[model samples]
Target chain A: MKTLALFVVVITGAMLIYAGHDLPAFGDINSPSYQAPMTQYFINNSLEESGVTNIVTALLASYRGYDTLGETAVIFTAGMAVMLLLRRRER
Target chain B: MSRIQESVIIRTIVRIMVPFIELFALYVIMHGASGPGGGFQGGVIFGAAIILYTMIYGIAEGKKKMSDSLDRILASTGLTIYAATGLICIVCGGMFLQYRAVPLLPDPAEVSKYLIDLVEIGIGITVLAVMISLFFDVSPPESEPEEAEE
Candidate 1:
């Protein structure tokens, strides 16, 4: 157990060192996100589309509401599965 | 605490209060649009009313109101309705749940709003009913399965 923990620490330390070389500086405005893929349209359009004030809520409930519904279904499926398993008789 | 006993005062209060609880649940469901509480929250609260009623009354009474088959219907119907509604958009040339291309009544925009709310209500009903059903299925009165095994 002790050796495994030490090995994990050494591997993590090396990985962190490698990761440090590739990350962008904090809050760089000149990145690709500043101009491309039209993030502004969805951000601006969802409020108008949903007629709701909260942006994330509008995006989640209206603009892309179906995705949220799918996620909710996933939750329901999971809960149902847990119930199904728990209700089974032991062999 | 022990089960609540029958008393004139308690009965009178419960008689008046239960209707209000049910009414409030409907209000939450109907007014989900342009409000914070939507179908999910409303459905949960609505189910809570039934669960509470059973607690106050008895399991037999609860079963009379909410049955096992009803639960299966609620759970299955909700998912089916959700998928079918999304499929409408796919048929209309947009992605799933793409309301813009949903192709609706004379004025599509206004109709879409109403339709979406209707869908939300379906989701609420299914979720709420199934949750209550699951609760009852797992914990039916005093006959806990684990106790029998012991």
Candidate 2:
């Protein structure tokens, strides 16, 4: 059973690596995302538009603030779930 | 205390290092708008400082510093701050999370810069509180669960 599991893992890994060959090289200018107009717009105007020097911060907190707000809620929910499940009651 | 935690050297170093680590976390959070670090990373670092303190000083001592009630409040407060910022935008006649809609500053971009910082702070607080509470919950209870300080 262990050998069969290992065989499955190895085949899956090999298939993933084989499929990775089609990916663009890191930071390739010709990559679809890099060539997109939105990407260019963000890169060029994030600082002036958002007044945040860090483009990632500008994107997260200003451009996509709703998404980040949702992420924060998710974190809060996880904490609450852990507390509810694990907290010991006082005797 | 365990032999390792009982060490004078370890205790002294941790005591000295925790404040600095927390200070660095604050720096990471505030500088996030201008630099590489952000709220999530900063909060994790801040939580780690407390966890390290707990490891050496024991859970009871750690709890005294950040009581369970306080942790819950901070967690809620951070989320409130984030949500409030968005609500304020709507009240000011703009879409949610729309920094320009806030009329605090003369320049919309300037308002955005400051609001971004405020939002980052909210994220940092929530992350810090949650991380610390999660660590407290998961770590094994000391030999005596309640106030076992020697």
Candidate 3:
């Protein structure tokens, strides 16, 4: 059974690596995402729109602020859950 | 943990290093707009400094610095800051989190820059609080509370 499982894992890993060959090269302008107008628009306008030099920050904190808000809530929830589970009761 | 606590050299190094680590975290959060780091990364770093201190000093001393109530309060407060920033945009007659809609400054771009900073700060606070609390919660209580009866 263990040998069969290892065989399955090895085959899957090999297949994944083989499939990864079709992926676009680093920073290829012809990549599907780079070809998209939305990506170009963000690149062109993010600095002007958000006055943030860092594109990632503009994307996270301004363009997609709602998503970040949810992410923050998720972290808070995780902390609360851990506290409830692991914290000792006061004597 | 006890072995480290007993080392004067280790204790002194950690005590000296924590403040600098915290300061660097603040720098990362503030410069998120222009640099590689953002709230999450900075918060994790900040929490790590505390965790390092806790690992050496023990959980009891760690709790004294960041009590359970304080942790809860800070975690909620960070989330509140994020939500409030969005709500304020709505109050300013813009959609939620519409930074340009805020009338804080003459230039909408300028307003966005500042609001983004505010949002980043909110995120940092929440992430920092949560990371510390999670560490405290997950780690075993190696030292018993002083008040515990024998």
Cα lDDT of model 2 by residue, B17-113, tens digit: 9999999999999999999989999998998888888878888999987889999999999999999999999999999998899999899999999
Off by over 4 Å in 3: A88-91, B142-150
For TM-score, the strongest prediction is 2
For residues B103-139, write the lDDT of model 1, one tens digit per residue. 5765555545665676677777776776676567555
Ranking by TM-score: 2, 3, 1
Off by over 4 Å in 1: A1-44, A51-57, A89-91, B5-8, B106-108, B142-150
Worst 10 residues of 2 chain B by lDDT: B141-150
Deviation of model 1 at B8, angstroms:
4.8
- The TM-scores of all predictions, comma-separated, are 0.69, 0.93, 0.92
- Docking quality (DockQ) for each candidate: 0.22, 0.89, 0.85
Q: Where does candidate 3 clash, by residue pair?
A: none
Tens-digit lDDT string for candidate 2 (A1-91): 9999999999999999999889888788899888899999999999988999999999999889999999999999999998888874632
What tens digits encode model 3's per-residue C-alpha lDDT throughout A20-60? 89989888889988889998999999998999999999999
Model 1: docking quality category: incorrect
Worst 10 residues of 3 chain B by lDDT: B141-150
lDDT of 2 at A74: 99
